[model samples]
Target: MELLNQFYANEKVKQTLVNFITDGRLPHAVLLEGEPGVGKNHFARLIAASSLCSGEKKPCGQCRNCRLVLQDTHPDVMLLSPDGADKPYSVHALRELILSCYVLPNDGDQKFYILRNVHEMSEQAQNTLLKIIEEPPPHVFFILTCQNHARILPTILSRVVTLTLWPCPVEICAQALKERNPDTDEEECLRLAKQSGGNIGRALSVLQDEHLSRIVKNAQEAAQLICDGKEFELLCLLNGYNRQKDDFLLFLGELRQIFVEALRQKYGASDKNFLPGAMLNRISALQTMRILDIIDKVSGEAAQNVSISLSGAHLCSALQQTLRG
Candidate 1:
C-alpha cells in the first residue's frame, strides 16, 4: 500500500479521507470494517500520515511528517491494539487513550488515534469510546478497525462515519505483490491472490512461505479422518491444535477449506460424505448450505472474542447438525 494512494474497492473511503484532509470535514470517529488481512491497517496508517503531514495534500510521501510516519515516530499519531493474548482491547488502554485525547496535538494541526481490532475492546472501553465519538475535540480523529462492525455498540456506530473496506481484487493483489517484490514469480503471485480471496496481505503470506504446505496436507488428512469415521484421529488433530495454539485460526481455516472441498466434491461424486456419524445422511445441497451457515456462525462468534475451545465445541455441534440432515 502506497499510503498516499493505492486504495482499492471503495471510493467512498477515499472520498471520506479526502473530506477530512481538504475540507476539514473530519469526523470525531470513523469505523473501518472489513475482512482480515485486507489492508485496513494500511489504510489507517495512510490516513494518520495524511493528517500529520504538513504538505498541501498532507501525505505527500515526500514531506518530513511522511518520513516520521514511515519511521514510526510520529508524535501526534497514536496506535493501540489488544495486548499479550492477541485479543481483547481492555478498558484500561481505552481509558488511558481517552485521557490523553484532551492533551491535544504536538507538532501538527491535528491528532490521529488509531485503535485496531476494536471488536475486542472491553465493555468499559467501548463506553468510553462512545463518549469520545459523541463529544470529541476538534482536531482529534479516531479510526477504529474491526472485522465485524456490529461488535461495536450501536451507539458508537451512530456517532461515527463508517467506511467498510472490501478485499482487494485478485488482479490488484497480484499487481501489488509484484510491485512490492519484483523477484516474485507471476504464476505463484496469481495463484496466491486467487487463493487468498482478495486479501493481498494473506496472499503474500501464502505465497512467500513454503512451510504451510504441511498445514494444508494435515488439513486434508484431517478431512479424510472425519470422512473415515476415525474419532481417534480427530482427537489427535484437536490435541495438536491445542499444543500449538498460535496457529489455531489457521487450523480452523484449513478444516473449513476441507469442508468446502468436500462440498465441492459433491458436484461429481455419486454418494458424497458430508460429515461423520449423525451428519452422514444430509443431501449435497443441504450440506453446502449448512457449511456456509457453520462458517458464518463460527466467524460471528469469533468477533466476540470467545475462547477457541468454546468456539470449537459449537463448531463441532454445527458440523454434526449439518451432516445429520
Candidate 2:
C-alpha cells in the first residue's frame, strides 16, 4: 500500500521499514508500539503489503497484491483481533491462528498475520504465539500492534523486532490533513493540530466532530466566568455540562488548553492563542501556574470516577479562590 509514504510522522521508523522491505530482510515477527492514533495499524499494514507485494518495488500501490491488502481482501493476509468480546485474545482463537498459519499461502509465496492490540493477549495466549514466532514457517510473517509494549511478555519481546512510533510535528500533520481534505481552512487545521497534541488521528477527529466548535466556545465562556469570579454564573454554566461525562471532560480539557496557551503567550511563544486578550492580560505567570495546579488536581480527581457536578463545583470554587486572590 502507499500508506507508508503517507505516514505523517516518524521518519526514522518509516526509513527503517523501507530498508527492511527493500533488502527483503523483514523480520518474521514485528511489534509496533505507539500512542493511540499514531498510525501503528497503518504502518503494520504497509509492512504486510511490502511482504506480499508481487511488483519489483515492494508495495507498489498499483499492484494486485497491494490493492488486495489496501482493500483488506487478501486471502494470504489474516487480521487477528480481539474475538468473542474479550479483553485478550481467547486461547482457542490463538490456537486456531497457529493452526491456520501452517497452511500454505493461498495466493502468494508468503502469508501475513496482523495482530491488533496484541498486548491485550493473556500470558498463555502470548506463550502460544511465541512458540510459532520462534519457529515459524519460512514464508509466514507476523505483525503485532499495541499501545503499550511493557505489558507484553519479555519472552515475546525478545523474539520480535520492536519499533516505537512517535507523534508527528504539527506542521507535518497539518500538511497531511490538507492533502487529504483540500477544502479545510488552514486556521482550522492549525487549531486541530495544536489541540490534538500532534496526534494525526486526533487532529482529523477534531475536524470531523461537529460539536467541537460549540465546546470551544463554551470553554472560553466558562473560563471567562471563572476568571471574572462569577461564582453563580460559573456553576450554572458548568451545570449545562455536568450531565454528560465526556462533554465535561472535553470542556475542562479545552479550558486547560487555554491556560496552557496563556503560559505560552507570556513567554512570547504562542501563535495560536485562543483565549481572549483581556483575560490573558489579567493572568500573571504565577497565577497561570496556580491555575494549572488546580486543573491538574481536578483532572486527577475526575479520573477516580468523581461525579461531574462535584468536579465542576470544585473546579469553579477553586478558580474563584485562585483568581480572586
Candidate 3:
C-alpha cells in the first residue's frame, strides 16, 4: 500500500495519476501500456489500492483496506491472468471475470479487477470484456496492463484511459538501483543504468548477469576481427556462438552499442565507446549501418526454426559484404 510516491522516472505519469486519484476523477477502465520492464504492473496495483482504500489519505498504507490489498487478501480485488498452459485469456475466462464484476464487494465500497498481459487476450475475449466495460457496474473498476497496445482492439482502447510508460532516465534508474541495493558499487550502477536504455528492470537485471563483461570483451574482439579481415577467425567465432543463443544475442547487442558509439565518435560527439581507436577508425558510418542491417536481418531469421550453422554462415557472408561495401 505504498503510495505512488516513488516511481523512479516518469514524473509526468506519476503526477497526472495522483491528480486523477486526488481529484476523484479516476476513470472506470485504465489501460497501463509500456515495455515489459517499465513497471506497468506495479502502477496498476498502486492505482487499485488507491481506489479501494477508505482512509483520510487515500491508500494510507496503515488503513485496513490498504493493508488487505497489499496483502492480496482483499475480497473485492480480482487479479486475472493467463491460466493452465494458455498464453492468451480465453473467452470463458473473460465471461467468468465479467460475471464476477456483478457480485457485491466483500468489504470495500469498490471492486477492482487487475488484468495482466491484456495484450494476450484474443479478439473475442476482448469483445466480451468490451460489453462489460461499456456499462460497467458503478462499484467496479478495471485496470489492464500490457506491453503492446497495438495488440488490443481499437474499440477496447477507445473505452479505457490509456497511460503509456516509457523508459526511466539513467540517473533515476541509477538512484533506484542504489536504493534497492545499497551495497552495489555506484560505478557499476551507473554502467548498468547507461546500458539499460532507461529500463529500470533491465538495469537491475544487468547487475545480475555475470556474463556481461565477457559479452563486452567478445564484442570488442569481434569488431577487431572483422576490421582485420580475419574471415576464418570470425567464422570460427560465429560457429562457437551457434550453441549459446542467449550469449550470442547479448554479444550482438553489445556489438550494436559499440557501433552506435562509433557513430557518435564519427560525428565528434562524446561517447563511452571502449573499442580501440584503430577499430573505430576502420569502419565508416555507412559500413556500420550496413553491418547493423545484416545483424538485424539475421536476428529476424533466427526467430524461425532455422539451423544455427546456416545463420552463422549467413552472418559470415554478410560481414564480408559489409566489410567490402
Best model number under TM-score: 3
lDDT of 1 by residue, 201-299 (tens): 676676666666456556557556555555455656655654344465666676675565456445544122323423333346566567657756765
Task: Estimate the overall C-alpha local distance difference test score of candidate 1.
Answer: 0.69
For each candidate, how many residue pairs have backbone atoms clashing (under 3 Å)? 2, 0, 0
**Candidate 3: residue 21 lDDT (0-100):** 81
Kindly indicate the candidate among 1 and 3 with the higher lDDT.
3
Question: Which lDDT value does model 2 have at 208?
Answer: 77
> Sort by TM-score, best first: what order?
3, 2, 1
Q: What TM-score against the true fold does each predicted structure earn?
A: 0.74, 0.75, 0.79
Using lDDT, rank the candidates from best to worst: 2, 3, 1
Give me the displacement of residue 65 in model 2, in angstroms: 0.5
Q: Against the correct fold, how does model 3 do in TM-score?
A: 0.79
Off by over 4 Å in 1: 84-89, 216-249, 257-285, 292-324
Candidate 2 lands at a TM-score of: 0.75
- The deviation in Å at residue 54 for candidate 2 is 1.4
The per-model lDDT (C-alpha) reads 0.69, 0.80, 0.78
